[model samples]
Target: MTGPGRRRAGAAAAVTAALLAAGCAGEPTPSSTPEDNRVFTNPVIRTDAPDPQAIRVGETWYLVHTNSGGRNVPVHTSPDLVAWTAAGDALPELPAWADPGRTWAPELIQLAPDRFVLYYTVADRASGRQCLGRAVAATPLGPYRDDSTGPLVCQAELGGSIDASPYRDTDGTLWLLWKNDGNAIGVDTWLWSQRLSDDGLRLVGTPTKLLKQTEPWEGSLVEGPFFHRHDGRLHLFFAANAYDRATYAEGYAVCAGPTGPCVKAAENPILRSNEVASGPGHASMVEQDGRTWLLYHAWPPGQEGSTDPGRQVWLDEVVWSDGKPVVKGPTQGPQPRP
Candidate 1:
């Protein structure tokens, strides 16, 4: 809800106002179309793709995510969104400006085939400089780098950080959706966006506020913003509530275009777990083999801490229509549906 230009994820700030935003239009949503939307084939990739990001390269589906290991985010590829194999870590060297926290929330965009950009949050928890950085590799999986001007976006104090999802509309104007939070240190947390320079990296227009506050079911945390185009509308999917509690959820929002005053649907918590996994948030969508699937992290019923690297990856078939996504349920593994 601010002016446009230089969009930065603020650190340690307060909410500017109550986010009382709602959905728009009575026009029929295309997410309801029976042909474009199909019944999902179960459990494609089961490896932990925390805050996963994906790109469709030709007939192949490639996925990458926040570093679940000691290094950068890892990339995995598959044909049907099921039966995946690891390619490699996206980045190997720790960014010079990066802190001990390594990297968080890895996002990928296919600006063109064989030419892709991987963006992530590199935080030096000690120095407290949370930065948004980029790495470019000719292939989907590679040894990506801090190839940008160091940080595409950075906030150090209380709310300084990164996690970016880029969108380009039919008009050719590119947009970026990222998290902003840090009220403890005067930073504000919400969804923010900005126009991109022709290259798709530099900030062009001013930052626009799209979403804030959130549904009560989401508790207090809001993060992991992923967007896609469907039936002429833009849909936003994000993780919400606390990270270590059962109340965590993956919610959704929809807009007609990139620059929205976007809207959240009442039927949120699109992908949530009431079982032992505490909270299940931070998600990404992959449109593969004539269908859509969702990837995110959950406690998996037996884990207790977030530091564990083997958080079991869960898959769900997403019903994307009407500018919104609906998750049928979680798949146990790669078994043929009955």
Candidate 2:
């Protein structure tokens, strides 16, 4: 565990208007800071930051979280995983193709030194169906633009889709994994993946069905897919159950390839609610200093004096034993910073 160390201008300072380009609206707002980052604990941001996906650029870590119906995607940057500060919005302006006030679960990746791609979920006005779309930017924090006035993937027949996660194989093939949202139509939400062009802007093949909410522990909903590779096998981690419910948890599947006939662990939901937090799900994984860490969201224990709070981000270390991933907590007490 390390302290926040030295602070830099990019993340620790306020974003100026000149840093943003056209279509993006709003000046950067300051994020409230709490206790010293030298020795921090869990619930990293201490505020609502759900479905967080983090990307590392040198020593700095940038995180993007879901902002349903918000003007732009919220971004946070941390010198150390334990101490985070607000950077700015990823998309200064919402994509024109999407209905106003409909953005959700955003995943940003760098394709080249100056090329960046953002994958997010939004809704269509005609069908009111949530779908996945793409935006491009010159920098990590940016005024992103959706060049196409359309979605990259929208399966109206499957009740629409969301939570666009990406995986680049060792061979340089790009693959996208997402959940076919069937919850609105009284059907099971399913995880699906398809190959993409090297540019990651176009789908290459028919989507492959990976997993469904069949396990008793998975409850009625399963969304938020994030992928990683370990021991030469692909691991697909996803959030399950209604996010507001106590049963919300994190489960994973081990597969042979990017899109696969995956096998869910018999002992499912590697992470779940404990005595302190009620709902813990929608996780993103990052490896730092040879240790794997999981960043997730959970509703604080409702009876513990919180006012029915929404999901807030939490961080914990993950240890792999016997080819399985184990999370250290839903820990509420203070511990060493990660």
Candidate 3:
């Protein structure tokens, strides 16, 4: 979900000003070096990095998040997940069909060593609804380009589609998962999936409706759907409830395949609001040294929708016990680096 509007340049400048102030006070400035520490705290990225999606290329990790600071897709890089530095805009230019300042939930995937595909949500001016678009880049931090005259996916009749996430199966089949913007029009919000072409440029088959909000804790909607494969089982993880409230939390379903017959866990909302953080959701998994880490955004407690330090990036471990996933956060204390 998008946070309050703020320019990216302004945010960077504010951070710089604070660091300079600390130096003037004879305090040691924080280091960006990944090896500076063995333990890390919450809000790994202490800025407005909402709806974060990350990928590891070699030893460096690259992250892209919702439009802010006047970038279509703001990109950041790190030697380790705890310390991040701004890497500039990934999609510097939006397609002809998209309206500016509304880009959100960018999902990055690598098809080859030099080929990267980004699926992102943008406002469709003609349809007056949010839609999905695709872009390509040669490197992880890209000046990715989209030359389409129209959106790649625009379910206008169902209030348009958003939150496009791509998943690759064990058999090498590519699938795209997203949430229908039904909440925008007061309709039932359903998570849908479809097959993607090998090139990652287009959808190939009919869309399948996976699941929708049914539980009370989910409130009226479910959004930000992504797939994770663990121990030969496919799990569909998603965020539910209102994005701006403390009730916004994350849940998962055990799917038989990418296109499921899926079942939500009885103990749903596995990762949720705690004393340390509020509304922790929109997560993507990264595996390092055989351990899985969830990279997500969270609102600072008592500051649910504030623009300052809005939706900072948080890292938590995901442990599997008896084949069920468990989140070990929103941890306030320092913990081992991923």
Candidate 4:
């Protein structure tokens, strides 16, 4: 995106010291850069940021990812991908209505300079109810508070919601997409969407079933539905399978129209990992400075490779070739958003 700004001198140094100490205690040290002139970058959001979402504001970049623990969801801000600092959680404490483990796929879209509408999967799994939830805050670094105590929306039992994402189309139509279990039909998971109210907290109408998995490589978990409009078409990107191996991938469906009965692109699994980076999915796409970037999580070689803690926040430049986006291999050094 842009070059990093100078931290507030002493105060930043102090906070950086505290965060670095907390980070390095059990986190992976900045990996060595490859000898082939690559860079070795540490972390932007070091925690288990399962669903990393990115957006660029003015010259500064902002990121938020899922915090399954119901703690404050993690947020990072920086001018460039390098030198990110903890901005603060959207909510340090969950609101009274938000039950335990309700936060998943915390995504933000800048409705205005100071206001943001965060869409997430908030549920009480124990009660067998799942729904899409919303929070609004005056600032990006949220202590986001939910105005609704009950679910903004809910679905059936086995269709328990997860991995939700947001997209605002060219016409200013707000859309929300989420995953519902597909185990019954023998598919991985199904992607569904609905138009959201202008405020983002209400549904304009019921969700329309968009696409399902039929490709062999996508496995049985066709989840993580996020739509990025490129060229004149819409690319619906999602994850498949258990996100713990190279097979864990991001698949895409191409729609001639923004909202569609789109077909999976022939390219299919557009973003998958190899031995270099495993289980890279649940990605968010942001176009900044005439460039596209995909922010997701993965297990780097020999570090945090265990699936126990699941995935962590990661970033890579998305190369455009033949109209589709190819997320490059893991990045070690900082790169401009361009």
Off by over 4 Å in 1: 1-48, 124-127, 183-188, 276-278, 302-310, 320-324, 333-338
For candidate 2, lDDT tens digit of each residue in 183-244?
76777788999998888899997999998889888877788887898777788898887666
lDDT of 4 by residue, 1-338 (tens): 00010011222234334544666412333333455224535344454456678777778877776543324466777666544555656766655655644456778887877888887765544445555678888877777888776666665454556666878898888888887754433434668888888878788866777876678887666777898888767888887765555677776888765458788878767667665567677788877668777777775645433533345667777877888777775655555434
The TM-scores of all predictions, comma-separated, are 0.78, 0.86, 0.92, 0.81
RMSD of each: 11.6, 7.9, 3.8, 7.6
- lDDT leader: 3
- Top TM-score prediction, candidate number: 3
Candidate 2: where are CA atoms >4 Å away? 1-38, 68-70, 303-309
Candidate 4 deviates by what RMSD?
A: 7.6
**Residue 227, candidate 1: C-alpha displacement in angstroms:** 1.4
- Model 3, residue 255: what's the lDDT? 96
Clashing pairs counted in every model: 27, 0, 2, 11
What value does the lDDT take at residue 315 in candidate 1? Answer: 60
Report how far residue 149 has shifted in candidate 3, in Å.
Answer: 1.7
Model 3 local distance difference test score = 0.85
Query: Which lDDT tens digits does candidate 3 get at residues 1-338?
Result: 52222223245335434543554212221333356477777777777778899999999999998876667788888887877777778998998888886788999999999999999999899998889999999998888999888998998888789899999898999999998888888888899999999999989979999999999999988888999999999999999988878999999999999889999999899999999999999999989999999999999889876766678889999999899999999997878888
Q: Report lDDT (CA) for all predictions.
A: 0.60, 0.73, 0.85, 0.64
lDDT at 227 for candidate 1? 75
